[model samples]
Target: MRAVRFHEHGGPDVLRVDEIDKPEISAHEILVEVAGAGVNPVDTYIREGATQPFTLPMIPGIDVGGTVAAVGDGVSGFDIGDPVYGTGIGKNHYGGYAEYVTVPDDRLVQLPEGVDPMVAGAAGVVSGTAWRALIDHGNLQAADTCLIHGGSGGVGHAAVQIAAASGANVITTAAPTYHDALTDLGADVVLDYGRSDLADAVRDAAGGGVDVILDHRLHEYLQFDADVANVGCRVLGIGENETGVGFERSSATRRKDLQLTMMTMFNTPDLRVPLRKLAYLMSEGDLEISIAETYGLEDAAKAQQHVIEESFLGKVVIVP
Candidate 1:
């Protein structure tokens, strides 16, 4: 199979397209012929050495949309011709960046009706993460005011729509350039991320501190989590910049009573349920996907470059 590989990591130029052996399947796995692969911030992070401990010559895509070309011996409920889409947990395995890739049958979901291949692959990861934050972790209610960081980006836009549809007034942070776009995605108020006094602006727009906040960048906002959280409110967000694996500052977080949401969509047992729910929303028009930009499979370099160049509004795709 022809696929892109990077033996040594540095920049997008390290990615090289060449023929590699197709992945071998285990008894409970399925092989997909790639239709589209979703490019994420993590893809670039891994490529650029920011996130590592990875094996060299890695293919860094996590989400893929395609049809089952072959099924392993013990697999059931899925046929060779069925359309499928899934996100591979990139902890140790090869991912969805080639003409063929293998995944455990349990991790795959039937591609939802009324959706295209690109949309299915694109929406899988962040949509699941956003839903896990708002619906599962935050315990958001109809009257709640929920604030989301990175409002114009992939996860933020999904959270904005879901929270608003669930009846919460959603406040979000975004660059001034994205205010109009964020509002169209159901953000009740869009605060400038460059400003430090957004709490005051949020108070002016809504009555008080928010009942919940879904965070993406936590290092800069770690102290502010309590300042804006309503007393007893759930601060369900991830602080990925802890400088190490396990989050530090346990005493402070405990003092705040923060319900820090640790979302790992790939490891859980019941992913398909939430994944199906996400597709239903998209098909019914309650959810919308924003594509910052797209590139062909051979143009993977440019796609990764764009992610480094700008903090974008939504997920990017590489169509093979």
Candidate 2:
């Protein structure tokens, strides 16, 4: 089997495709013939040594969409040739950037009929993160006014769709070019994040402030988030880390009784919880998965570079 492995983290160039022994599954795992794998920001973080990966000589991928070639003895409800998709790859274990990868059965979800495997791969982390932030953390209601930052990116795009489907009035930020496309995806208002008065723009659109904010670009918009949150608003942080940014936490806390949620899927150990709901939504066409680019499995390095340098509109996938 061929796999992408990085012995030491530095840059995209560190990734190399090499012949490796096929992974042997544990009793509760499944062997998947890799079809597609999603690339995310954390993939780069691990590659660049920004985050401490569980192991070295690592295959860096978190989500996959593929056919089950075989299942371990302890695995049931899934069998040979079943199409499935889910997360739990490349996190202290082998991932989908190869000819074959082993995954725990619990982390895999059966794909719905007619859902593209590439789309399923893209939905794993980004869509699940969006679902966690808005529905799980924010507790968004139908009449809520919600602001989604970085709306044209992977998680942001999913956030827009989810908020709109829940009947919330959706406001999003992106480059001016993506405004029309975002509106088509159910955003009630799209604001250019480059604007100096973005807080005012959000306020104007949502009648003075919004009830929930999904802030992907946390450092760039933390203060603005504070300004635009309505009374008792929920502010969920997805991408940014708190150590880099400093703001007046007391004011937001005292003034609006805001609830701040900083999240990563790793914070919750169970991948199955979000995967079930996300799979159902994808099956029903209630959620959309966007693929910004697809590269051959051997081009994993190039794929990682694209994720870092490009302001791509959605997930970048590696098709093995």
Candidate 3:
């Protein structure tokens, strides 16, 4: 099997394509023949040795969509040739950036009918993260007014749709170029994130303050979120600055009694639960995975670069 592996942590240039033996499955694992793999910003962080400690020569892909080539003896409810997609592949083990990779049975969800492999591959992390942020952590409800930052990005896009489908008044911030698309995706209000009066805009849109806030750039938006959140609001933070910058709790944050939750998809105890729901949403057309770009396995380095440095509306996928 051909795989893209980085022997050392650095820039995307460190990723290289190599012919490697296919991974073997454990009793609780399933061997997936890779069809598409999603490249995420965290992949770049992992490649640069910025996150948790990882071994060298790692394959840096987290989301995968592929077919079950072989099933573990202990794994039930799956068989060879079944389409599957999920995350947690590249974090601690050999990941999806190869022709074949081993994934835990519980981490692999059956791809719903009519979902394309590329979209399924891209949907895993973003959709699951969005579901966790908006539905689980933020506790968004139909009567709530939800504000989502970076609504044109991967998780942002998914979060907007999820918030809308939940019947919440979805207020999202994105570039003006994406406002129409986001509105079509169920965002009730689309504000320009670059606007100087973004907080005021959000307050106006939500009729004073939003009930829930989903933020990816906490460092940039923490105080802004506090300013625009309704009393007792829930704010979910999924990403932040890699520079280890600190934020101060503002008076509004304290006075309003905001509930702040920082989350990572890996921290989820049962990934299959949220993954199953996201798959169902995809199947029902309530959720859509937008592919910003697709690259061959050999161009994994470029894919990583595009994911981190480039500004794109959705996920970048690797087709092996």
Candidate 4:
């Protein structure tokens, strides 16, 4: 099997493609033929040594969607040729950058009928985060108002749709160029995050302040999040760490009785939770997944570069 691995971490140039041994499955794991894999900021973080440390050689990617080439012992209700998707690939283990990868059955979710693998690969991270944030952490209610940053991006678009589907009035931030797209996704308010004063703008759209704030860009918008949050409202942040402002305990703990949630779509025991809901939602037309673009497995460098540049709106995928 060919996989992307880097011996040293520094820049995108470190990514190297090489022939690697196919992963062997544990008793509870499944072997998936890699049809598509999603690129996320954490992929770059792992690749660049900004997040967790790994062995000298590593393949970096987050999620995979493909047919099960085979199932391991003790794994039931799943068989060969079944389509599935899930996270935790490149984080604690080897990920989907290879032609084939092994995944724990608990982390794998069968793809819904008609859900494309590439789109699932693209939707994997964002949709899972949206579910954990809005439905699980934020305690979203139909009458509540919420805001999401980077609305046209992967999680942002999914958050908008999920919140709206849950009956929450959703406001989102995007480059002005993506306003129409956000609106079409059911965003009641869409603000330009590239401009200054995101808090004031989102606040005005919500008619005062929002009950929940879902932010993908934490550092630049932390203080702004504090400003726009309604009293007693919760603020959920996904992925951003180590920088920006207001992340300090003193500042983040300041009044409005705020609840700050750090969101992760992986490392959960109940992997079936979001997968089942995402399946039902996708089938019911209540949730949507979007792909910004696709790259080949060998183009991993460009994909990493794209993450650093933040030039893409949604997940960038590598199709095998």
Superposed model 2: Cα runs more than 4 Å off: none
What TM-score would each prediction reach against the true structure? Answer: 0.89, 0.96, 0.97, 0.92
Q: lDDT per residue, candidate 2, 186-265, as tens digits?
A: 89999999998887889999998889999877787777787888889999988665567646565655687778898887
> What's model 2's overall lDDT?
0.86
**Per-candidate local distance difference test:** 0.77, 0.86, 0.87, 0.81
> How far does residue 60 in candidate 4 sit from its true spot (Å)?
1.3
| Better lDDT candidate (1, 4) | 4
**Candidate 1 local lDDT, 1-320, one digit each (tens):** 97777788788899878788888889988998888778877787777877662588887687877888889999988888777877754435676767888877766778767777677777777888788778887898997999888788778888999998899988898999999998998888899988977877876666877788887777666557666766667876554566644335556556556666656555556767777788788878888878777777688898877766777888788777
Alpha-carbon deviation at 209 in model 1, angstroms: 1.6
Lowest summed lDDT window (length 10), candidate 1: 244-253
Q: How much is the lDDT of residue 85 in candidate 1?
A: 79
Q: Write the per-residue lDDT of candidate 4 for residues 112-207, one digit (tens) a residue.
A: 788776677666677888888988989999979998888887788889999999898888888888898788888888888777766677878888
Candidate 4: stretches off by over 4 Å:
241-244, 247-255
**Which should have the higher lDDT, number 2 or number 3?**
3
Clashes of 3: 0
